[model samples]
Target: MPLHILDRLNHPLWPAARAIYERSFPPHGRKPEALLRRMLERGQAYVFVLANEDSQARLHPAAAMALAGPGGSGLIVDYLAVDPALRGQGLGSRLLDELERWALERTTASALVIETEAGAGKENEGRRVFWERAGFVAPDGHVHRYIWVPEPYAAMYRPLPGREGGLLPPPSGRQLFRWIEGFHARAYRGFREEE
Candidate 1:
């Protein structure tokens, strides 16, 4: 499997990757396609599609992920989804692993962070478990609420390995929240938050 960084709408994998992204999240939970395009064009994000080669060596998208930051703040897992037909095959984990490597080798991010729904529900619980299995842990206190997102979310992070393979310390919850907020500010520049 290979991870393709799709930074343009004309990329060969864009259609499949976009379809998978649209189907994975509800409209309110996802950025509009136009905004996503702007993010790519501005180099504000890293959008990746995990692909596998077919018999003829043609690559087909299996999963998609996008992230921002790691530009001194931290790397946030903006969105990650395995194709509906390919769910339960551990492709999500594989993609995430590749993402971590990319971050480690390519940036100065101190940690890899994610936001999962905070309420009580099986879906939320399952998401938490999946991230936890990947070594992400929630901060001791705080359910971060964003002005634009209706659902309350909890922040989780796995500190990246530092120089000489030493582990970086986890960031404080306040710092993590700030990094998340900064990402939203940049990604949603023209949109206003509800009061």
Candidate 2:
């Protein structure tokens, strides 16, 4: 049977969501389940589950994407993940489409924005291709540095009509640095500092 997508936060099958994420990104270096719970608690995140229509049991999450409220002028894609088993099955694209439709339903948002690593490594290259295929364009003049790594990363934005410049303002170096610091603090909260 085909899967149906639902928006139940307390769905019985929610626990498996983390396992699916772990399988896809084993070396992700962070626990996604904890973060997902936090996001959901904040009410800024949504979980879309793909399940069998007959029994409503989750087969697997075809795709999962979270959107934070409008930062400067647009919405930010806080996180996006798809089950590895469902990759390349058009589920990712469908999830993105639903996200856009969601944004359009909001009266205040004008565009959607997301950040991703830049350049040509296996992971980075694949991410770039996916965003490009989803209609995201890398802005010509913006670069944000990674907190853990010294290298800088590019920013990408997808302008929605009337919200072209409504998204978060481009970050300055000082601002970016602060962001990096915050990211590291949260991402490694319980880990001991290197001696």
Candidate 3:
């Protein structure tokens, strides 16, 4: 039997979801169980888990990303990670397709936006290429600072329709922080104090 992907929040597959995330992401000094719990609490975000039927085992998610609505604009993907073992398997592309489909159904915003590091070396360069292949483009005259990682990254955008007429101005630090704070609040609802 083949593996299938499902929304973790809707399914409440915390144990399986945490396992997949742990396998894909570095511990980074944060407890994996706690992190997964926080991500689940962020009701605004969606987590897709891939599972295999044959073994009745949730295949560690080959790829994962988080989405949030920022200021009523389209969905913003906060994080995207693919399992190291499955990098070239097309899982990332499939995961993105799911995100777009979900966004199209739920919002009137004309696009989905994300950020990645600039000059991020080979690893991030590959990620940038992946985004490009998926139809995303860099906004004209706009550069984003990706502060979560060790190094900063630039922001990228994928216009759905009608959004091509204009570009959202880059957010100021304070504004960006407020937006992220909302996202964090939702994402870490139950784990806020530890986060």
Candidate 4:
């Protein structure tokens, strides 16, 4: 499988990739496809897919991921999902590896940051574990609750590869939060944080 950076929204495999994205996250957790299109058009965000090309040159997309930044100190993994039938095959980790390489080569992001649900009883522990295995770290006892979403979320980060392919220390929780907040303020204008 090869990782594809989606520069045009109308690519042949776009619908399939978008389907994977829509089904992966709940309505409250995802940005509208329209917004995504606008961001793509304006180069405000990036979308990636892992796919296979068959003999006739058609693409079969297996996973999709969207990202929001290297802006204001954060590179947010806004959404990521593998096809439901393709779970446990390490496609997600492959995608992350490709993404990290791409970011390292093309951008100067401090780290790759993501938000995972942290509320009790939310069945998100496995999700957190997956991130941990991919080298993301979150501070213990810290959760950010948004007003528009009921579940509390913890921000986790994997430091980008530093000079000579070494890993830098992860960014602080405050820096991670700022990156997420700055991106969301522009991308999710009406949403606010819980006081």
Q: State which candidate has the highest TM-score.
A: 1
- Give the best candidate by lDDT: 1
In model 3, which runs have C-alpha deviations exceeding 4 angstroms? 1-12, 29-39, 53-72, 141-150, 161-191
Superior by TM-score: candidate 2 or candidate 4: 4
Model 3 worst lDDT run, 10 consecutive residues? 1-10
Q: What are the runs in model 1 whose C-alpha is more than 4 Å off? A: 55-60, 67-72, 163-169, 191-195
User: In model 4, which range of ten residues has the least summed lDDT?
Assistant: 163-172
Candidate 1, position 190, lDDT: 76
- Model 1: weakest 10-residue lDDT segment is 163-172
lDDT scores of the candidates, listed in order? 0.75, 0.55, 0.55, 0.73
- Residue 58, candidate 4: how far off, in angstroms? 7.5
CA deviation > 4 Å runs, candidate 2: 1-9, 26-32, 50-58, 61-69, 149-151, 165-195
lDDT at 16 for candidate 1? 80
Overall local distance difference test of candidate 1: 0.75
Of 1 and 4, the candidate ranking higher by lDDT: 1
lDDT of 3 at 150: 60
User: Once model 1 is optimally superposed onto the true structure by TM-score, how far is the C-alpha of residue 98 displaced, in angstroms?
Assistant: 0.5
Q: What is candidate 2's lDDT per residue for 24-91, written digit by digit as tens?
A: 55455434555545545655445544433443234643344333434444456555666666578776
Task: Candidate 2: count the clashes.
Answer: 3
**Over 4 Å off in model 4, which ranges?**
54-60, 163-170, 189-195
